[model samples]
Target: MQKIIVGVLVATFSVNVLAWGQLGHRVTGAIAQQHLTAQAQAVVTALLPNEDLAEASTYPDEMRSSPEEFWQKEAGPFHYVTVPEGQTYAQVGAPEQGDGISALKMFTATMKDSKASQADKQLALRFIVHIIGDLHQPLHAGNGTDRGGNDVKVNFFWQDSNLHRVWDSELLGQRELSYTEWTARLNRKISQQDISAWSDIDPQVWVSESVKIRDEIYPQEEKISWDYLYNHLPQVQERLKMGGIRIATYLNALFK
Candidate 1:
């Protein structure tokens, strides 16, 4: 089975190590940047003058290779959460290692701190931008047994890959779209009412959303192909769209 989309690829950094991969995150960033309010946009520009959300979206994932202690240790859990099959994220609660929900709250506060240095705030903003996007991919809030599907191996379009890799990049990468093209392709209609409907900055709520979709992401067969792709591609699109809208919502509220 396989899925669908439009456009050519723009090369980026390592894809296998991150949630939603590079293109997905950049698409979320591009959509979020477009929807940001004037005040929010000003704040974003102030922090990451050269890079908009599209470019800044991949910063955290890129840091996976960093020799810095913070990136090596503190940033891993911030990229995903583990909400088991039946229980809600609340019942299980985030562990002491910290999760996307808590990490996001931490980053949000850092960005909002007036006493925080420009360097610190910039770093926090990038983290927030990236993590919010990460939390939307259903596999990020994994079922706990499969290491977010990393252990669940499969052949995607005849290549060796796992469930997590399929969702992260295989699907998006197969589209052959640049981040800008992916952004434009996924940036759907966002009316004022739609914006109002999309509000709610809680990361826990975001986790719940992921859990619901996570249920639909799997197949009984390890040999998934085109049919499997067609069924779940819509979920990928929806998640990316929601990720962008919600990121913009949080930043707008934060800066407003």
Candidate 2:
């Protein structure tokens, strides 16, 4: 009976995540490319045997939320990758904080955790790629509420959606392109310097940058209409392009 309930919850969360285009997963793929060094890229490229692509997806929860009602204690790998209290990713957490300064810290810890099995590490690496991408999106940092923009409702291209959903898919998914197609479309024209600059991995810097752009991306009004999105397509595309490149940069660092 306990197992059955756990399976049902996992199914629900998976559906919610997928309905959002698995934005975090898509970004992970982009970041994996960004972070892979040339040599690592070659390795990953080869690793991309058809089987690999077919099997790629985010990890499922190892242990479901227990206590029947403790949603906050569910403790997925994502929980550790988020911002801690009071301090932004740019500033170091107080000395008592356990390497809570950046998502990368969590990434490194999970990679080295004795408790995590080999499969867990693989899952961690995938999410590390994804979480890095998540960190880059300003709204994901949020202002201590709304689970980023997940709570902020709006109309995206005539569909009812929230600001978080818009950032998750409305923008990136608009082109209806595959990962390669989307990456190729955006990759050709970025200047080398710009790529180098955007690739910086400082969590504080990423957070700060996201906060600054947050307002521009999401206006205060709740019912953002089609005109709003149309007006912001350029901005939307820029974020997606940046997201793809920065993801590659972070992933490259890992393999290097």
Candidate 3:
């Protein structure tokens, strides 16, 4: 009975929800690349061949513009998991086709698969890098309502924007930092214990953390400006930092 309920909830799962815009993904990617182990860096280099981890971070998102049926179907649902307000990913049950949580698990498995083709592994690595960054952007773990804040329209500096878009690029974009600069600004010496703790955390756990942020981020009014930015900017940077650190953790584990 419990299994049937979970299956039913999973069936209605949505996919390819919006994520951190290009610059944000790159920021996290750069951070992760900086922290990778020598062994992991070697494997990532071999897998990507021409692209560095930071450069490859946006591939999954870039592919969204492709018209291929395979990409349209297979790559869609992995971008996010809708946890809904007041509920957790596990409590709501993940879709069988997979959300970010399931996709992260699957993509990591593909990365470790000796039988997987180089192209396939490369694709997996890109998706893995993108998804970890996505999972950190509070909005990526959408609530069952509001389409992950996409439907929640608001004004940024008197310009129209949605809540998700604010987090995706607008908020992060406010800093006007290049990806490299963002990486440099956010670079911190993660304590050994913090690295150990963050590296192996489950995707479901990421969703839970994101959901908490999502809930708290709802603006008191429709207009957001520097005051809002001033307050939440640190929170945003922290997410980026965690995204980078955790991403390195995932890569290090895969290549180790």
Highest lDDT model number: 1
RMSD of each: 7.9, 7.1, 3.4
Ranked by lDDT from best down, the candidates are 1, 3, 2
The TM-scores, one per candidate, come to 0.91, 0.68, 0.90
Q: Candidate 3 overall Cα lDDT vs. reference? A: 0.81
lDDT of 3 at 71: 69
Residue 76 in model 2: lDDT? 30
> Candidate 2: what lDDT?
0.53
Candidate 3 regions with alpha-carbon error over 4 angstroms: 1-16, 189-197
Clashes of 1: 6
- For each candidate in the order shown, give its overall lDDT on alpha carbons: 0.82, 0.53, 0.81
**Clashing residue pair totals per candidate (backbone < 3 A):** 6, 15, 3
Look at candidate 1 and give me any clashing residue pairs: 1-225, 1-226, 1-227, 2-225, 2-226, 8-176
Better structure of 1 and 2 per TM-score: 1
For candidate 2, the C-alpha RMSD (Å) to the true structure equals 7.1
